[model samples]
Structures are given as C-alpha cells and as structure tokens.
Target chain A: MHIPDGYLGPTTCGIFYVAMLPLWVTAAKIVKKTLRAKQVPMLAIGAAFSFVIMMFNVPIPGGTTGHAVGGALVGILLGPWAGCIAITVALVVQALLFGDGGITAIGANCFNMAFVLPFAGYYIYKAISYNASIDAKRRVIAAGIAGYLALNLAAGLTGFEFGIQPFLHKTASGQALYCPYGLNVALPAMLGEHLLVFGWVEAIVTALVIKYLQKQSPEFLEEGRKN
Target chain B: MSKGNNFIEYSIAGALSFLKESIFADEYATKEGFLQSLDPRIKVITFLLFISAILFTKSITISLCLYAICLALAYFSNVNMWFFLKRTWIFIPIFSLFIAIPAIFNIFTPGEVLFTLKLLGLKLIITQQGLFTAVLFVTRVIASVSFAVLLSITTKHFALLKVLRIFGIPQVFVMTLGMCYRYIYLFLEVVENTYLAIKSRVGTRLHYKKGQQIIAWNISSLWHRSYYLNEAVYNAMLSRGYTGEPALLNDFRVKSKDWVWLFFTTVFFVILLYLNRK
Candidate 1:
C-alpha cells in the first residue's frame, strides 16, 4: 500500500525522507564498490524491465488484476543494492512520467516496496538458503516463498505506517488521533488484499524468477548455492 | 542463454534507449546529489517530524501551507517543475478516487444538502462541509506526494539506508535493503535482454498469450540464482571483515549553509502555521 501524498501528515512524510538519507549514502557506496562498467547497461535494462513488467496485469482468483514489484527477484539475481536502486529508479520514473504515484509519495512508496521489500526479501532468502542443504528445486521453492512472504511483510509495514502511525499520536489509550475506526478498517484491508489477492501473484512471479536465474545465470547464486 | 547481444535487436529499441537514458540515468544522478549534503541522523529525525506534522494536520489551510513549503524546497533544490508535475499526475486519479468514493457515503448521511442531485438509487448531495472535506483530502494527498518526491530526488538511497542503521532501525532490515540495491538491476538486465531476444524472434506479430508465462518462468529461475548470489555476497562481506554493525567514517559535515537552510525552512513553515491559525 503506497501512502499517497496527503494521506500522511507533512511531518511523517518529511521524517521518512530524513530517515532514508543514510540508506541512500550506503547504497551509493555499495554501488561504487560493486558496479562494473559492463554492469551499467544491464542495470538500465533492468530498470526498463521493471517498468514494463509492472505494467502487465496478472489475473487473481476473483476478477481483480495484480502485479509484482519483483524486488526479491531482482535482489536475488543482481544483489540487493542494485535491486533497490533499480526498483527505486523504476518507481521514480513511473511516478514522474506515468503519475501512478505522487511525487511526494515517492519516498514512502520507495521506502515500502523498493527499499524495504527487496532488502527484507534478500535476507529472508539468505537465511533460508543458509540453513538448508537443498538442491536447485528446493532452493527455488524457498526463494519463491521468501520473495512472496517478504512482499507481504513490506505491505504490513506500509499499513503500519499509514494505518497505525497516526494512532501513535493518540494517547496509548486511544483518544482518536484521526479515527480509530478508519485505522482499524485500513489495517485489515491492506493486509487482506496483499495476503490474498496480490501475495499469490507475487509468489508465482518470485518462483518463476528464481527458476530463470538458476537455469540461465547460476553465478547469481554464488553466495547461497550449495555445492 | 541470454539473447540480443547487439544493439540491432528491435525496431523500437531506440525509444527504449531514449527512455532509459532520460529517466534512469538522470534520476540516479539526482538521487546522488541531494543525499550527499545532509546529516543522516538529522535528516531522518527531521523527516520523521515532518511526516508527523503532515499527518496531524487536517485543516485545509495548514495543508496548503505545508504544500507551498514543499514547493519552495523543490525550487530551492533546483528540481525541475515539469519533473515534479509529471510524477504527481500518476497518483491523482487513484488518490482522488480513493477519497471521492468514500465521500459518496458522506453525502446522504449529512442529512442537509448544500446541493442535491438525483442519481442511481441514492441522492448525490454535496454539502458545503462535505465538499470542503473532499477538497482537503485531495489537497493533503497532493501535498504529501510532492514532498516525498522532492526528498527522494534530492537524496541518495545509500545515505538513507545508513541513516536507518544509525538510528537503531534493525540491522536485518538495513542489511536486506543493502542487498536489494546490490542486485535489482542485474535481474532487470536479464529480463530486458531476454525480452529483446523474444521481440526479435517473435517479430511484430508478437502479442503472444504465453509471453507472461515465459516471463514468469524466467523470474522463477532468477529467484533460484539470487539465493546463491546472496551467499556469495555474504562471504564477500565476511572476507572484508564486515562485523555485525558496519563502521561509518563520519563523512557528513553540517556546513553553515545547511544550518542556514534548515533554520530558514523551519521558520518559514512556522510562519505558515501562524498565518493559518490567524
């Protein structure tokens, strides 16, 4: 759930950007250390791919359409820093060029899907990979599950920011910062939608991406690949 | 194997190239520039304060004032006006629709209609207050979106991550984000190269139904590879003596200019608040 510009107060919006600054620096250093000249073109293409992939709608169980951020997919293949940068780039372009999300809301959205999800997904994948001694098949399954679950966890955090955050200003006893009912309503809806409708699509996409990289570009698995 | 080794893959490749250069490169450059200047700790705390203020404000006047301040910051940052406009447009429909849909319920429930109309099975009453509330909602959304974009454009993603770590946000979270940034684009390149190949082979009649399936299959494989990649990265980190907590060299220096800028902006917002209250 991308928090639109006005949905959050100015303070919350501004603070998150501030909070995000150090991460941005670390990201830059990581890129500087890691990115090769040959990798640049690939990264650009990946950025474009992000745009194209998000545009295509996948069908859910009911009638609604959904798409994957594919954060983990990218993180798993290229490394999480590149994945974060690529997705943030994609999201910024989408917001600026397409207007799907607001310019002001870009930080929040990036924080949610791009910054949070990919990183979380990467670690989860790593933790699982570390513990297991599975072959390719099982590894792929673990990656897929991790990717899908990570996205939902990211969504949950977004809900917490948008849905539960305002309530924090309210007394702990609940004196109505905005509307308790509204917060109550939004929390479940966000979690439900992500879990049921979008989560499965994400899982499927995550699974497919894991499989592709395993078969085509196994170097991507250098860290987690069990000999 | 990946396809499209050369630039001559697709007829429309030029368009994609242009978009890639204009949108992607410029954004990375911009992100790099803004994030370099501020103290991550200060930035993070300031941002938190701003978010709280924005969420706390319900008054249209206050919201507008906050929005104006955001615009002023954007202008100062030398961010292009058109760039800002273009980004904000995407969310307008969704934002408006989200607010407007709920407002429909507010119409009939208000009892007294400032304006009434006949509609399908329900009254489309627009009370002055309801209308005002609607406008405020939209305004708030716009304000928040604009500010966020400005922040992202100005700041680098790495800086933000470091700030998160420094601020006692969990290490796992920071590590995850770091890894995500490391690899996202490599995955994209794979997809892009594959698509280019697919496009060349499939030709102009290539709106195949199974394209999605192909993409999904590729993504599945990508995930498998990514896990191993993560492990390799971890080893690299370990080899480099990466302890649980990363060491920072204290690169940020708050110049007099930053202090001046921060002070002026804070004062400006305060003035706006005063005016709104008056």
Candidate 2:
C-alpha cells in the first residue's frame, strides 16, 4: 500500500502536498486547544503506539499472519484530530528512516491513511454506535465495520490516484509517464487485495482492540469520549 | 530475524531489530566523511537538488548516471558499498520492477513490437515503448531511493528530523516528531520485554484465539501505559520549568567548503538539465 517514488507524477504529488497543508494546520490547532501542554507527549506516545502497532503479526483464518493499519483504532482511541497527527508522524518516520514509503508520496500516503482512514472510521463508528455505552457490543461492531469501510475507502482512493497518472502525464503516443496501469488495472488491483484480505484484518484488529481496551483501559476510552 | 514460525518471537524480534538496525545505520553517520561534515540543512537541500534532477530527466542513461553519483557520494561518506546496495536495491525499486513487468506487455501498453513470446498457449508481445517506459520508471525509482537512503545514512536521524525546519514545518510538529523518535525506542523495548514474559509463561505456538488475545492485550496495555506515561512525563517537564516553546541546541555551523560543494552541485545539476534537453 506504500506508494514508492516515481509511481506518481510531480503534479499529483504537489497537489496532495498542497491539499494536506491546511488539514495539518487545522489538526494542530484543534489538538493544542484541546490538549494544551499535553499535546506533545500525548501525540508522541500515540504516534509511537501506532508505529509499533504495525509490527504486531496477528493470525487470521488462513494460517497466514497479517498486520493492521490501526489508523481507525487510533482514531477511536485518541480522537480523530490527534490520531491524524500521530499517524502522520509515524508515516514520516517510515518514509524517511525506514523507506517503507517514498518521501515524495508522504503527503499522498498521509492523506489516505492518516486523514481519510481515521476520520472516516471515527465518524462512522460514532454514527453507528450512536450513544452506546463505552463497553457496549454495539461499539465493537461499529469499530469493526468502520475499520473495514475506512480501509476500503482509502484503498479505493489510492487506486484512483494511481489510475489517473497515465491520463494526467503521458506522451503524445500514449506511453504513461508515471504509473503505467490505467484505471482498468490499477483500481481493481489495489481494491481487490484490501477488500479481500486487509479489510478483514483491519476489522478484527480494530474490534478486538476496542474490546480489550473497554475492559482493561476504560479510562483512556473515556478520554477519547470527550472529543 | 524478521520472520519465524512463532508470531510472538517474530513481532518482538522485528521491533527490536528495527531498533538495532537504526543503531547500526547510525554508525555511518558517526564516521568523519564528506556528507557527515556538511551542515545537515545544507546536506538536505543538495540532496533535494539531486533528486529533482533525477526525477525531471526522462532519459534512463541520465538517471543511471545520477545513481552512480549516489554510489560515489556514499563511498566518500564512508558507507560500505554492499550495505548501501542491499539497503536501496532490496527496497521498493525491486517491487517496482514487478509492477513494470505488466506495463511492458501489449495489453497494457501499445507500441512498436520488440519481441513476442508464447506462454501457456497464448501469444504475448513486448513493445519497445513499453519496455523503455518500464526501464525508465525503474531507473528513476532506483536513483531517487538511492539519494534518499544516502541522505538518511550520512546524517543522524534526530538531526534529519530537526532539519525539517528548513521546509517551514511548524515548530510544534517538529518537536513532536523528535519526541516520537525518542519514545519509539522505549515502547519498542517494552514490546520486547512483554513478549519475552509471555513466551516464558506460554511458550511459542499458541492457539490462534490465544494469539488474538495476546495481541489485543499488547495493543491495549501499550495504550494504557502510553497514556500514563504522557501524564507523568508532562508533569516532570513542568516541574523543571518547561513551557510550550522549546530551547534547542544549535550546533550546526556552515563551512566554506559546504558552499563550494553546493555551488558544484548546482553546476552539475545545470549540466544535467542541459544534457536532458539535448
């Protein structure tokens, strides 16, 4: 899911960077107003939490293990705004130090996983769980569904971004200047993998974590309940 | 070390190995070498110029030449050639080749037929434009990644994050990034120790249901611990007269040689641009 360098045209990457600017600013403002001096350590620990979350290998039905994005879980656990910043920090580390993702694609990758994934998952859980108690099974169900849908949505947008590269940047004779796969190939390939395999992984992880935290660390869930 | 039959050991080893890998990579930064001596801010800017030159050029020859420059820069920086190659080549550029494989066929790209192969009772045509496009894509990816990897290896990670100020990033965000880097190691240790405790009690190859339970326990316990750490850590800083604004150490001093090298890189970039036009 990490888009490497050279897969996106400069224009596309630039647009994503421009688009993410205001969102980052707004998130920072909201977090500062809410957490005050606590935002630094809070967001830092949250970011580290999300970073290590990806290292966990959970067993799925098929005997093979997979890791969860944990974006939605973070959103649900630490409100969406802080979650965005947390995940953004993690993505930056992954891009710069680990090279799990491309430096140029940081903006695009954060927009998808950090922004869209968390907010979509958070709001969907909110709407579905609607006034349910912190420990309600309904909340667990909401987290699961939110995780599935949010991941799919992000994956779909990633495909759409890759699909448009050929249309936006191509030679006169139609040779793609960036990603060669058009919508016909890119969209399904990205979505198929996520929808079939990753979505389930995300759902189970999100739901299970929510379930565990509800019993083990309800205090934190109560903090998330505030905003 | 990254893979194993036991998920517990795998996760623990993977997380701790990242810590070890990071420490190992920092060795290159500590060496007295070309990139290590330059001010990190300047190093970042010149690397950006190199990447821009690589990305903007359409020729595979030019991209490969830029990649060679990356190797040369790495050598002068005291980074081992094999380590650098393993770091860069085994990354996304290799995966980019597989992605390019499909793009080289006639079904995805239509162009001059370079050759045809019959596989599984089906005729496949490889197109010249498709092949060139694929090669160009892979070359560009490799060059860009090499430059990025070189920059990171030659500069300390914290210094790298601090240089984000060069891009006008918010001070708060930059501080948080530094903090994130700091505590990631702490939690990584906690992950290792916790897994070790679990393995001692339960051993490897737990039931899948038990694995989920343990994973859930890991996630939830980490969250609880992080929340508690946040409160304690913030208060400790406050007692030490901490405020929102940070006073950071400013140790970087630009030398004349750095300026000369910057100028040389600009000239080299202009020459590449000229040749690109040719």
Candidate 3:
C-alpha cells in the first residue's frame, strides 16, 4: 500500500511534497522547543517500540499479515509529537537504508503514515477526553476508536491519493484504466476488511497501551492534560 | 565497519544533494508554470482529489495514458527524472506479485480453459478474464503508486499537517505529527552514532552470533532508552511553562499564485477527463 514514485502523475507527487513542507518545519520547531536533555531516552524507546512492534507483523486472520502501525501506542506513551517524530524517522531510515519504500516516495509515505496517523489519532483522543462528562472508560473507548480510525484514515488517504490518477480518463475504455472512487474501492474494502477481521486487534492494542500509560505514569500526559 | 560505511557512500551523497537542493532551491521560481506556490491546504485537497480520480480508473490504456501525462508533469518540475524513476521501482516487485497471483490462480482453478495444457493428468489453463483482471490490477496499482510518489516528493511536511489541522483534524494527532517531525532528527542522530559504535566494535567479522544478538539487544535497549527519555522530557516541559495549547505558526494566506496553480490544475484535470471520455 506504500506508494512508490513514478506510479502517480508528477503533479500529484509535487503537490503532496509541497503540502508536507510546512508541517515538517513546524514539527522541527516544536521539537527544538520541547525536546530537552531528559526526553532523549523516551524518544529512543518510542523509536524502538515502533521498530520492534512493527517487526512482529500481527497476523491478520485472512492469512495475510499486516503489522501494527503503533501510531496511537506511541502517542499514548510518548506525547504524540514524540510519537510522530519517532515513527517518521523510523520510516525514513527504513526506506533509505532498508529499501522498504522508494526514496522519492518517502515524503508521501511519511506524510500519510508518520504525519497524518499519529496526529489525527492524538487529537481524537484529546477531544474525547476534554468533555467533562466523559469517564475514563469512555476516554479509553475514544482512544481506541481514534487509534483504529486514524490508521484506517491514513490507509484511506493513500487509497484516495492513488485513486486520483484514474479520474483523468473520460471514455468507457479510459474509465477502464482507473478506479472512479478510490475511497470506495480502497478505503472501505481495506478498512472494512480490517474492521471485520482486524479492527479488534487495532482497538485492543490501542486500549491496552493507553490503559497502561495512564496507570503507570499519569504525568507523561501531564502537558496534554492542560490542553 | 568499512563495508557498512562503504555501502552507504552512494546513498549519503544522494541524500546530501537532495538536502542541498531543498536548502538552496529558490522558493520563488516557477519551473512548472504556476503549481509550485499553491497554498498547502489547496494543494493537499487537490492532491487528494487527484488520487481519488486515479483510483476510479480501471483500464490499462487509460492508466498508461495517465501515467504518460504524469511523466510530463515530472519533467516540468525539473527534479531529476532518474530520481523519480528510481523511486517508482519500489512498487514493481509488489505489483508483479499482484499480477502473477491471478494468472497463476487461473491456471490452477478448474475453469473453462481459454488456453490449456494437460500435464500428468493435471490441467493448466489460463482464463481470458483472469489474465485481463491481472493486467487491470497491475495498471491500477502502478498508476496509484506513481501518483502517491508524485505528490509526496514535491511537497513539504509542514504544509500538509496545517491542512490536516485546518480540515478539523484533532489537535492531538496534529501535535503528534508536529512533534514527530521535530524530533525525527534526534532519533536519526542516535541511530547513526549507534551504527558507528557497532561498526567500530565488530569490524568486518560480522560474527553471525554476536551480530545477531547485538541487533536483538539494540532493539530492546533502544525501547528502554526511549521510555526513560520520554519521562525526562515530560518533566522538562513542566519546568519550562509548558501548557497543552501548542504554539502554532501564524496562519498563511493563499496567495494569488496558489489560486492560479489550483485553477490550472483543476482545469487540466477537467480537460483530461473530457478527453478521456472523448
């Protein structure tokens, strides 16, 4: 599902990179301001968590194996910013050193998996928590939903981006060349398949991790609590 | 150690050049007519729409045609086309597998043979539909992969996240991405140092047992280290007047250049769509 370069029209890739630039800059600034000497170990652990967890490649019941994105897990343990940065670095290294993703495609892959998923999941968790009426159990549920949905949303974005090229064709024959709604074809099917088959894993993993983080060290999210 | 360092020599140069280009490239230049300066939000939306358009397509001929146009677009960007092609290579193996499976399945399944052979009482038949479906899948996959690459390489990360946030993406997720971007370098620096240290210790013997164990230990230790680091970081934030409301950059205005780019792309897509129908 990770896009390689050249498969998409250049316009699409160029635009995506353009879009990514600002976010990258902002993230850099934030890290510079917030990352102190003490956080180095946590950042390292988050990176290690990302790498080790991904290495396991959770078994999807249909006989295909898909690894945990671990976006929310990292977000829960380390602040989302740390989680996102750690994952992004991990992906970049994986692509460059291991040849896992295309070098050209790194921006898109990073944008989708590293940038989009963790951020989306984090806020979703936050939004749910902010409501005074919500109990811890609800917050946990919200966290679960946010984490699961964020992963799928990232997958959905990939599908949507991939879906863009085919819309250019007009004829029935041309129509044959592309999928009309990338969302329907890729997202729902992929998300649906996961929902029916793998959603539980996503939810469970997310819930358990969030629970542990909250219980073990409530202070980890202390900064986030004020927000 | 030498071998490891040597392996990365080629890539390090490429990375350096890209960094140079990113650092030095003139922000004002419009190499590709006008698409370069579009607001990140508009670009993000447009990119998403473009991807959806491609996904809607299923025909090989259309996919090929669309791919041709994208190639031309890349040329306009003036980024090295070779670099672009190299990036797309990652998808070939995966797509090849995708194409091969259905063809192989067709041969094994007991279907009316469009083409058939009998070997030792086992039938090997390829159905026309199976072959067509496989080809169709390949073209679609190829088209999608290329499209994704096209969007990512040219954009920066910051702009994309802003768009995400503006589009009502949760702050937690947005902050997560921002922090991730901020500190990725910190991790990389650590990894690079670790690699160097490991190389110094295990010069070339590449002792299979020790090397393997070291790799495993690295993974575990890395986790422990990062965990402690997070605790320390949180405490630091507390001392430094850190509240939950993330400090954000001032909002950007969508310049006229951005509108022009958006208009042009929209028009171009509309035209391509019209032509495809014709």
Candidate 4:
C-alpha cells in the first residue's frame, strides 16, 4: 500500500504535496489547541503504536497472515487531527528510515493514509456509533464498518492516482512516462487486494480492538470525543 | 488447522528475522564510514536534490547511471554490498515489476510488436514500446529507492531526526518523530515477548479464530498499558525540566569537507540534469 517513488510522475506528486500542505497545517493547529501537555505523550505513543502495529501478524482464515494499517483505528481512538499528525509522523519515518514508502511521494502517501483514511473513518465511526450507549455492541460494529470502508476509500484514491498517470503524463510517442496502467487496470488491481483481503483484516482488527477497549479502557475511546 | 499453525509459525519467524535485519542496520549506522562522516543535514539536502533530479529525467540511461552512483556510494560507506543490494532491490523493484507487467502487453500500451505468442486461441503481443516503458518505470523506481535506502543506512536514526529539526521542521513534529523512533523498538520487544508467550502456552494447531482474538487482545492490552506509560513518561520529562523542547548536545557545524562534498554533489546533479534533458 506504500506507493514507492517513480510510480507517480513528478506532476502527480507535486499536486498531492500542494493539496496536503494546508491540510497538514490545519492538523498541526488543531493538535496544538486541543492536545494538552499530558496528552502530548499520548499522541507520541499513538504514533509509535501505529508504527509497530504492522509488525503484529494476524492470522487469517486461509492459512495466511495479514496486518492492519491501523490508520482507522488511530482515528477512532485519537481524533482525526491527532490521528492525522500521528500517522503522518509514522509515514515519514517509514519513508526516511525504512524506505517502505517513497520520500518524494510522502505527501501522496500521507494524503491517502493520513488525511483521507482517518477523517473518513472517524466520521463514519461517529455517525454510526452516535447516541449509542458507551458499551453498546453497535459501537464495535460501527468501528468495523468504518475501518472496512476507510481502507477501500483510500485504496480507491490510490488507484485513481496510479490510473491517471498514463493519461496525464506521457511522451510525445504516446508511451507512458510513469505508471503505465490506466484506470482500467490500476483501479481494480488496488481495490481488489484491499476489498478481498486487507480491508477485512482492518475491519476485524478495528472491531476487536474496540471491543477489548470497551471492556478494559473505555476512556481511550472517549478521548476522541473530547477532541 | 495444522496448516494454519504452520502459517503462524512461519510468519512469526519471518517477522522476527526482518526485525533482526533492521536492528543490524541500526548498529551499522554508527560505524565509521564515508557517508557517516558527512553532516546529516547536508546528506539530507543532497539526497533530496538527487531524488528530485532523478524524478525529472525520463531517460533510462541516466536513471541507471544514478542507480550506479548509489551503489558506489554504498560501497564507499562500507555498507555490506549484498545487504545493500538485497535491501534496495528486494521490495520496490520487484513490486514495480508486478505493476509494470501488464503495461508490457499490447493491450495496455500498443506499439510495434516485438514478439507474438499464441495462448488459448488468443494472441499476446509484447510491444517494443511497452517493454521500454516498463524498463523505464522499474529503473526509475530502483534508482529512487536505492538513494532512499542509502540515506537511511548511513545515518543514525536519532541524528536524522535532529537534522530534520535543524532544517526548520516544526519542533513538535520532530519531537514526535524522535519519540516514535525511540519507542518503536521497545514496543517491538514487547510485541515479540507477547507472541512468544502465546506460542509457548499453545499446545499446537491453534484455531485461526482463536489466534485472531489473541492478537487483537494483545494489541488492546498494549494500548491500555501505553496510557499509563505515557503519563509516567511525561512526568519523567517534567522532572528533567523538559519544556516542550528537547535539547541535543551535538552541535552541527559546516566544516570545509562538508562544503567540498556539497559542491561536488551540486555539480554532479547539474551535470546529470543537463545530460537527462539532452
């Protein structure tokens, strides 16, 4: 799911960076105003959690293993703003430290995982879980649905980014300069993997985590509400 | 059920080995080497410049040459050659090849047919233009990833975060990054121990459903523990007079050698850009 560099042309990368700059600024402002000094540690720990959560290999049904991106879970636990900031930090570290994602494509990666996934997931979770009792099973169901949908939405945006490359950037001879596949190929390839596999993993992880938190640390869920 | 147990066992092994390799890389960063001797701030800027230059060029030759430069840099930096090659090529290039595979068929990018094959009463043609396009995409990705990996392996993680702070990145963002980097390894150990404990307790052939629940339960417990840990850490910071700003004692000064390195990189980038445009 991490888009490496050279997959998207410079034009696409630049556009995403431009689009994300203001969003990042707004996120920083929101975090500054709402995140208290004590909560600052929570934000840092949340980022750390997102970073290492991928290392936990969850066993799926077909004798295979998968991991959740944890973006939606972060958004549901921390508010969207804090989630955005936390995941952005994780993404940047992955790019710079592990080269898991592209350095130039940091903005694009963050736009999808940080901004789009968290905000969309957070709202979906809020809308579904709204007015439910704190311990309602509906809350867990809402988290599952939100996570599943958020991952698919992010995957769709990523597919569009890859799919548009050939159309928007090509040589005079009509050869693709960057990603060679148009939307017809890129969209299905990205969405298929997520919809069939990773999305469900995310949903299960989110729902189960929410359930456990409800039993153990319900206050963690309430933190996002205060924000 | 037995197969599921094998899958869990193999994945745990895979995850552990991968973590071990990264820990090795972390130790390598502190070793004396060519790239390590350079100022991290300068390294970050020059790497960004090189990456930008790579992105602007459409020529395969220039991209290959840039990739070669990265290999040479890695060699001079004393990074194990096999390790460097494995790190760079194993993930990005292979993944890009899969993405680029469909592009090589005539159905995606139509051009002069290089080869034709008959399968299932349907013709599959590999176009000359399509092959070139795929190679171009893969080479560009390889070059970019190599430089990124080079930067990472050659610099200490904390020093790299400090460099970001020196380059005008927001203090809070840098602090968060620093904290994240520090805590990730610790948490990885916690996770490893948790998995080990689970593995030890289980007799064999753990049900997939049970495995998922256990993993989820561990994650939730980790988060719950982090709540108290965060408060404890913040209080520790308060005792140390941390006022939302982390202080680093390592002062960075631009020595003459750094200037020379910067000048060389700038000239090299200009030359590459010129050749790329031509």
**Candidate 2 C-alpha lDDT tens digits along B1-278:** 12233778678778877887788789999999999999998898899889888767778888889999899999998999998998898858898898899889999898999999999999999999899889989998998899888888889999999888879887778888898888889988998999889888875456666777788888888888998899898987788777878655768889998899899999999999898776
Q: Name the 10 consecutive residues with the lowest summed lDDT in model 4 chain A.
A: A53-62
Tens digits of per-residue lDDT for model 1, A149-196: 888888887776666543543333322223222556566767898887
DockQ of each: 0.16, 0.61, 0.10, 0.73
Q: Tens-digit lDDT track for model 3 on B1-278?
A: 11123322222333344445433323212345323555667766665555545544444676677677667766776756776676654546465545345443453222344777677998677765455545655665555556555555555556555556776644545555555544444444454456566666655533222332343344334444555666766776667766755556747678877777678768866765775454
Instruction: Score residue B14 of candidate 1 by CA lDDT.
Output: 33
Better of 2 and 3 by DockQ: 2
What is the C-alpha local distance difference test score of candidate 2? 0.87
Q: Categorize the docking of model 1.
A: incorrect
List, in order, the clash count of every candidate structure. 119, 0, 79, 0
Report every candidate's CA lDDT: 0.58, 0.87, 0.55, 0.87
Question: Residue B58's C-alpha lDDT in candidate 4?
Answer: 79
Mind giving the per-residue lDDT tens digits that candidate 4 earns over A1-227?
78999989899999999999999899999888888887777778888888877767778887788878888988988889999999999999899998889998999999999999999899999999998877899999999999999999999999999999989888878889898998998999999999999999999999999999999888888876777
- Give lDDT tens digits, candidate 4, residues B1-278: 53455535654675587678778778778888888899889988889988998898878888888899889989888899998888889978998988788789899889999999898999999998899899999999999999998898898878888888766778788888999887877777787777777778785887778887887898898888777899899999999899976766667777788889999999988988787666
For model 2 the local lDDT of residue B70 reads 90
Tell me how far the alpha carbon of residue B218 in candidate 1 is from the true structure, in angstroms, after superposition.
1.7
Tens digits of per-residue lDDT, candidate 1, B59-91, equal 667777777877776666566677666665454
TM-score of 3: 0.53
Clashes of 2: 0
True A-B contacts kept by model 3: 0.12
